[model samples]
Target: MTEYSRKQEALDYHAKPKPGKLAISVTKPFTTYGELSLAYTPGVAEPVKAIRDDPEDAYRYTSKGNLVAVISNGTAVLGLGDTGALASKPVMEGKAVLFKKFADVNVFDIEVDADDPADFIDTVERIAPTFGGINLEDIAAPHCFEIEAALIERLDIPVFHDDQHGTAIIVAAGLINALELQGKTLADARIVCMGAGAAGVASMKLLLEMGAQLDNVFMCDRRGVIHADRDDLSEHKAQFATKTDLRSVDDAIAQADVFIGLSGPDTVSKEQIATMPARPIVFALSNPTPEISPEDARSVRDDLIMATGRSDYPNQINNVLGFPYIFRGALDVRARRINMAMCVAAARAMGELARQPVPNSVLEAHEQREMAFGPDYIVPSPFDPRLIDYIPPAVARAAVDTGVARTEYPSHYPQPVVETDRD
Candidate 1:
């Protein structure tokens, strides 16, 4: 589609049929005056009183068990920088759509206008009672890191920054499969990451936690490689800073086994990609336009396995594959937090799922009759029905095993038929 047509279609999509992508619906009977009494006045008061007796009862009587808040300050929208909170509502609403459609999780898209991280944290904590979990969206780095940490400490519910950990989880999943295909492992690979922002920092951290050696990973930002010699590094960047002589992204990519780009468009040249050794794994995750286009990257070496954030390409490292299912498991078990165990479990599950035979539904969705766990098919498709049954149980089991769960393992996890008030 042409750029103008695409813009018009997007605008019309949000403007027509409804003013936005979401609406509130009553999930219980309310047509009759008798039902109204139960929904609002005397009968509602019974559940309210029960909740007052024990705060845990709120999940029993309310939508809090399956409801998530998609919160954003809009400082760093994907492909669009600092669009502001109000401008970010459409994106958050889009996130809500994904949450509901993919995992059947109800969502409230909240756009906070607070500039201060503490203020944003306070606002979220005050409204924390309404949600089973919080999915922070599009907030810029450093602050995104701070807000997530603060809220995770203060709130009992699961809090996740999708741009950070969600992206990272999916990256880990694809990378695991990619490594298997390339005969490489995270522990020994020379990995060059061309970004020091939220996704870059979080991806590196998760990989480190998953057994990637700190010295084997090289991180670069606008000023070049994050090194111990750089005095201007933030704490997050400092965590990856090394004493290497490699000063640029290009320098880091040479002889590296993996090149992961969470940076800007075309930041790494074809010449730079050509410098990598045989059987390199490349994830050019910069959206809309990658650091190096697959065509250009592939032209350099036939042994390269590539992934991108765009769905147009094969092996897309999509957050949609991670967040919904992760939260589904968390909500099912009433988990207090989405910890490292849960994330690693989800990643491992996703990696393993791709190796299984592709379901017909997944093949049909992608206009394919068959797909194997190879270079292009390293991660499970977002539309794969097995995702509902596969990843969430792994996450829920991990949550239970790690002692973060408030409830026992649910016996009724299915592609469930949710009870709605529709008559």
Candidate 2:
């Protein structure tokens, strides 16, 4: 199908089935008078009073424990750039759908038209009582960092910017498996990151937490390398700034063990890929189109492992693999925040899941005959049912271990479901 045809189909899918992609569904029946009374008025007031007396009781009596608020200011809707809040509704709703389908978590997509970071943070903090967790989406960098940090400090519930941590977690997981496949270690890998925005910065930080050395990592923004010499750097970007002589993507990619591209399409050339070290790993994760196409990268060196944001390619490093499961675990444990421990734990769980035997169901979903812990299969399929069972437990345990959990870990996690799983 042509691009125009696909675009039309997407519009039809969203428009034809009602005006939007999501709607509210009442969990309790309210057919009879007694049922209606219990759902509202007198019975509801009892729980309200109980929660007033002990705020923790709100989780027991209300949907707050299972509810996640997907809030976005829409300053940066994916690669679209500053599309504004109303324009980002569909993407937020799509995120809501993923939360429900992947982890059985409930999401209310909230789009706030606040341009100021302070206003966005305040708006989210005011509604903190209504949600178990907040998934911050599509707010641009520098401000996004400020918004998330301020909210995390102010709110007791978990506030995670999926654009930063979600992308980071999945990238770390896939990079772990890819490094293993190439017989390389994170500590030793000479890394080149081609974007200094949210995902690029966060992924590098997470890697540092996971044992990647600071000096081994080189970050690049549009203004070439993010080195110490650059004066016009945001505080977030400054964290990754190295005192390097390397000034260009070409200079950084030379002899690098890993090349991570979170930048625009076709920014990397086949010549750059050829300059990388033997058995290198490249994650060209720019959406729709990657910094370097998989074919172009592979044509230069067959020994290299490649991953992209596009699902049509092998070893796609998609954020869907992280956010749903991460939030599921955070909500399950009543985590005060999504700490680095939780993020690392989730990444470790995903990396370990990749090494396990591929279920026949997964192979069939991808229309493949077989799959294993190889170059092409470094990340678990998003449809893998085991993710619900595997990720949340690890994350919850990490939360408990890190002393961020408000409640004890549940004995019965990921309760069995009847629905058939698909990728």
Candidate 1 at 92: error in angstroms? 0.8
lDDT of 1 by residue, 1-423 (tens): 999999999999999987999999988877899999998888889999999999999899999999999999989887789999999999999999999999999999999998799999999999999999999999988899899999999999999999999999999888988887898888888899988889999899998888799889999888888889989988989999888988977778896899999988988888988989889999999998999899999888899899999999999998999999999999999999999988888888888788889888888899987888899999999988888887898889889989999998888864322212111
> For candidate 2, lDDT tens digit of each residue in 320-415?
899999999999989999999899889888888888899998988999998998989999998788998878888988888899999888788743
Error of 2 at 357 (Å): 1.1
In model 2, the worst 10-residue window by lDDT is 414-423
Q: TM-score for all predictions?
A: 0.96, 0.96
- Name the runs in model 2 displaced over 4 angstroms: 414-423
Q: Candidate 1: worst 10 consecutive residues by lDDT?
A: 414-423
Q: Residue 87: error of model 2 in Å?
A: 1.0
How far does residue 389 in candidate 1 sit from its true spot (Å)?
0.9
lDDT of 2: 0.90
